[model samples]
Target: MTYGEFWVHYLRAHQRTGTRALHYTGSVLALALVAAAAISGDWWLLPAAVVVGYGLAWIGHFAVEGNRPATFGHPVWSLVSDYRMLLLWLTGRLGPHLVRAAEER
Candidate 1:
């Protein structure tokens, strides 16, 4: 699959059945925040981004998704996919239907 396809699958993998969709949401949020901070050259936001980003992600993993993160298994791929997904999301193209296409595969 392409990078775009990987991102959609990544999101789907994080979605839970009934509880809040915090894992994917948190991961997306953190990625966007970090990208914004990095682009703005705010060094302070760097630390905050790291803390908040991972904190939110962990919360989602342990609390919401209830599964080990793919990051643990595929660190580099997961990191690259996170940024790619964040860009896709920020561009307003990360809709449910589009990402849902990934599930079909």
Candidate 2:
């Protein structure tokens, strides 16, 4: 699927509070890793961060959230969505989606 399509689904999957938390943690991991890589000038640290961060997130999705991660099907888009959701959460807009979903349910 195109990244755009995957983004839509990714956002939907993240509507849940727990799922959003996982995304936030993953974003923080990725950002921290990148920052470390930049500061230490160790390129390899970037990949390590990506793996560790995403690994924790996938585990959270499966074990805690009881859902398959969209990353399995759309890695790039999932990453983009992770950042987008992170921004939304940080900006206090994430709850709107949750509220809307709850209303639908």
On TM-score, the candidate that comes out on top is: 2
Model 1 residue 95 lDDT score? 69
- How far off is residue 87 in model 2, in Å? 0.3
**Model 1: per-residue lDDT, tens digit, 8-66?**
66676555532124434656666677788879987677677666666666677677767
**TM-score, cand. 2:** 0.79
Off by over 4 Å in 1: 1-8, 16-49, 96-98
Clashing pairs in 1: none
Model 1 lDDT at residue 63: 78
Q: 1-105, model 2: which lDDT tens digit per residue?
A: 776556566666665566667667877988998999999999999899888778878877887777889878877777777887788779988777556645654
lDDT of each: 0.62, 0.76
